[model samples]
Target: MTTDAVDAPSGRSASFTVLTTGYTLSTGPGVAATVSYVTDGGRHVVVDPGMVAHRDRILGPLAELGLTADRVTDVVLSHHHPDNTLNVGLFGEATVHDHKAEYRADQWLDRDADGHALTPSLRLIATPGHSPEDITLLAGTPDGVVAFVGDLWWRPNGPVEDPVSPDQAVLRASRERVLAVADVIVPGHGAPFRAADALL
Candidate 1:
């Protein structure tokens, strides 16, 4: 809804802004999910492109900011779940990044530090649990480490325990790991939250 930019960490010339389409799905009253877009310099970098039907709602906000789908350089998926990855193919010009086990493959970053460097300031993290191949995008900007944790949790409400998840224990540990470092949290299915508030 807003075009808010964050200063790139370590004095990189290019700055980026992360805008979410708020809550897309209408599963129930108060049960809405989010699909996020990161404007890294100029190209649009999207994560967890929710439902295919909600494509316009997601892209519409980006268009308002002057970035378009054709400029999306990477469609980084957090997991194989349809709510998160099914619509990834919509970004025809972008490469989909995730572990091969769950969905499409190609740019796989196996380790935590091996993030897919979208720009000098932004990258992706392999955060599994919601699914074996789940990942999160980490943007090192002046605001702090902004984590786009798809399916890792449902924001202010907390973690999800779906029958599909391989290991909730690992998810718990990953959440702790992420919270310890992240300043801003953009959950898969809710509004953005502060990591500090979640820790408390």
Candidate 2:
């Protein structure tokens, strides 16, 4: 089936909206980033910045919602994949936070550098399967808990696997951790789902 972009608000809260930037699939290319945004009290945090092509498109719709990248106080990455972290540099002063294991100097999140604190509502869980630096963000919102699983799994299609990959075991364990706590699942490249029991 052809892919299309989708956006849905939390059923429990009217203030938060989840936007999907769609995915890019070509002859040899895999899926692109599925960026997610969280808005709380005028503060914004972008989960998984994705690549440059998706960056502008991701931020474009925000303006219509009365939000802008400049207003983004935090950039939370689910992992260190280029598709997820490429546009991190776009947010100049925004505090970038991610799994300490996957962080790089060039990437947005630099502990030595100044940025915003990790919101109490959000917790970072290290899920290393797709990559050693892979992680998932658990957000405690008024609507419920949302887990942004970057590359850990995809919507409808299920988990993306690499048989010979070293972190296969860790990936499975990580998936369990996410499934046990998240009420909603936001994959790295598809629409958000309300599957509290689904796991990779």
Candidate 3:
């Protein structure tokens, strides 16, 4: 996956820019780890670190932007999929907060890894349809709330697969949890959206 500078759509607040770390399976040409960074004072958060295949490429652009993994305060994973989490250990020093039920402590191991500390401000809303561990991170900001919804739904142009994992009920509940609070919906792959129509 290659990094690209996408122009923020009109009407969006100019304080932040959404940096796409290439496409992944869930997004087709649009699938990607949609990591967002606020250009100024807000906390530095990486929505999904993506797989090892695109790790260096993803971080390289951040370096050019004068940002490093160590500087990242939060690594929010939408789910427990390997593509979104395989490289999580790389950001050893940052607090790795995820869905409490989905989090596995052993996944944080590395030779020089700094243990992760979970934060309560960010709530892990259970959204399990795509996978049993799928959950969205509800991040509250002074402006509004941002929901990092992993594979809950793909990019509008991406393939539409049924989110049926035997845990469909849980997944539906998760979607509701996000719909209740998210002002901005940032999926695991593809672009971010502001309206409910954008989510479907």
Candidate 4:
């Protein structure tokens, strides 16, 4: 429900808004991945448009922001997990970005996510742990760098440990790397939080 913006050299501002704060039920089978909308000049990006309680949770917010799915120029997936990629086709007009490539229509472009700049203020960094294919989106805004991290911390208070991570040590390293630059973190299944408050 809030937007943050940062002015870029090209006189365009980069901005982002949490379209829907996602959630997961600890006691039952329920989960929704946090989805976000980001804009850098003419580029409109959607991050992790995955499973949600309802599609309105995603569309309604975009509509409120004066945008429609067709206007999204790009879609970034954090990993291949169903909870993080199930709704990707929702933005069919968008060129999809994942760990290793970009997909649009029938064209597939091979590229590494790490150090890749999607726009003047949005870049990707490799953060494999939750999944070997995991990547984090780094967005520059007035509030500082906000990282869209997939299940990196789950929540600010911490899952302390990620039970499903292929390598907990690697995950910890990834968390540290993000904390080094991100002032705020948009976790996969929770509202954003201050990076300093994140529990490893």
Candidate 5:
């Protein structure tokens, strides 16, 4: 199947201890997950760990920062898709978080509206439809709110956009939700791009 994931582009930094994975993944060419990081000084949070087969590529950025998997404080999966969540086990001892709904049917809580806190700044948003449990992370950095949005879609015709999904309405709604809020978008695929007032 054609997927939206593209090799993350290089030389990009977002805000508040976050760095974009330049062409994330070691799986040859057209396929890759644009993994990102959100660090709070001492603690490191990794987004979209990518495939377990390409763990090194996902963890490579952390390595460059003089960190190993043990240094990771949290592993946040945007969803359980193999390209995004397969490497969570590599972050030894790090707390794993995802949209709670993935595990249960009831108790579906809206963390964003409930003022659920992740740090002093990071807010968890439940954005379904890419998969039922896709989560978009919003970190309040000095620059502005940078959102780590997983598999919402690819850039404007750059490459990859699944023509149909099981829940097209939900995906569009979730994408709109992110666009309404985030200043910078670290998409599941492609390079980090500006999203505030950006055409969907």
Candidate 6:
């Protein structure tokens, strides 16, 4: 699965806030996916509104930011895994984006998400390995480019390799692709970390 380099979006810059930091417990197989809120002008995008200790863990921060579920304009799912997509229906009015299409209401617009710009500063790119359908959201911010990479990495230090990745080689390639452009990374089940400090 060779993919082209992800080019940074030009012009505008978006802002992001982690609604809830996530975790994966080594014992009992417990996990919660990190959820984020990104603001690119009028586009309020939520990335991976997955499993959480409570729904408020996902919504409380939004309220703190003066937003409601309906205010979210877009919802992005990195993949269709249950842990990463459990709360998708919360944003009923949002246009949902995945690796291959834009889903809104009754319309399923077939389109490649790679390099698909949701705004001048926010885009999606294909970065599969943890799952064949995985995609990462790239946001151009004032500080630098932030890559919201779902499970491509569990965290900065990592398992060094994903235990469940279908193709280790492809996963390694995807990590390199992200490292080439990202200044910071919002990993799948952890807080954001500087790309320079990654154990990759």
**Candidate 5 total steric clashes:** 1
Question: Model 4: runs farther than 4 Å from truth?
Answer: 1-12, 27-29
Which ten-residue region of model 4 has the weakest summed lDDT?
A: 1-10
Candidate ordering by lDDT (highest first): 6, 4, 1, 2, 5, 3
| Per-residue lDDT of 120 in model 6 | 84
lDDT of 2 by residue, 1-200 (tens): 21100111122221345555546463125556777787554458788878635456777766767777777777788766677777787676576777662243455333421112245555566677877777676666776677788778756356546442467778787777677666788887667877554655
Candidate 1 lDDT over residue span 46-75, tens digit each: 777766445677677778877777777777
Q: What is the lDDT for 68 in model 3?
A: 87
Between candidates 4 and 6, the TM-score winner: 6
Clashing pairs in 4: none
Comparing 4 with 5 on lDDT, the higher-scoring candidate is: 4
lDDT of 4 by residue, 22-111 (tens): 777872269998999988868999999999988998999999989988999999999998988888888989999999999999999999
Counted clashes in each candidate structure: 0, 0, 4, 0, 1, 0
Worst 10 residues of 5 by lDDT: 2-11
Best model number under TM-score: 6
Please write out the lDDT profile of model 6 over residues 45-101, one tens digit for every residue: 999999988899999999999999999999999999988899999999999999999
Tally clashing residue pairs in candidate 3: 4
**Which candidate tops lDDT?**
6
Q: Which ten residues in a row have the lowest lDDT in candidate 1?
A: 1-10
TM-score of 6: 0.94
Cα error of candidate 5 at position 94, Å: 0.5
Local error of candidate 3 at residue 89 (angstroms)? 2.8
- Superposition error at 116 for model 6 (Å): 0.4
Tens digit of lDDT per residue, candidate 5, span 1-200?
Answer: 11111111111232443333434333235556767778764557888777533567666667887888888787777877777776677776676667762211233333332223456566667777767777777776767677787776544222233453468778777777776666787777566778753444
Model 1 lDDT, residue 118, Cα: 63
Q: Write the candidate numbers in order of decreasing TM-score.
A: 6, 4, 1, 2, 5, 3
Error of 1 at 174 (Å): 0.6
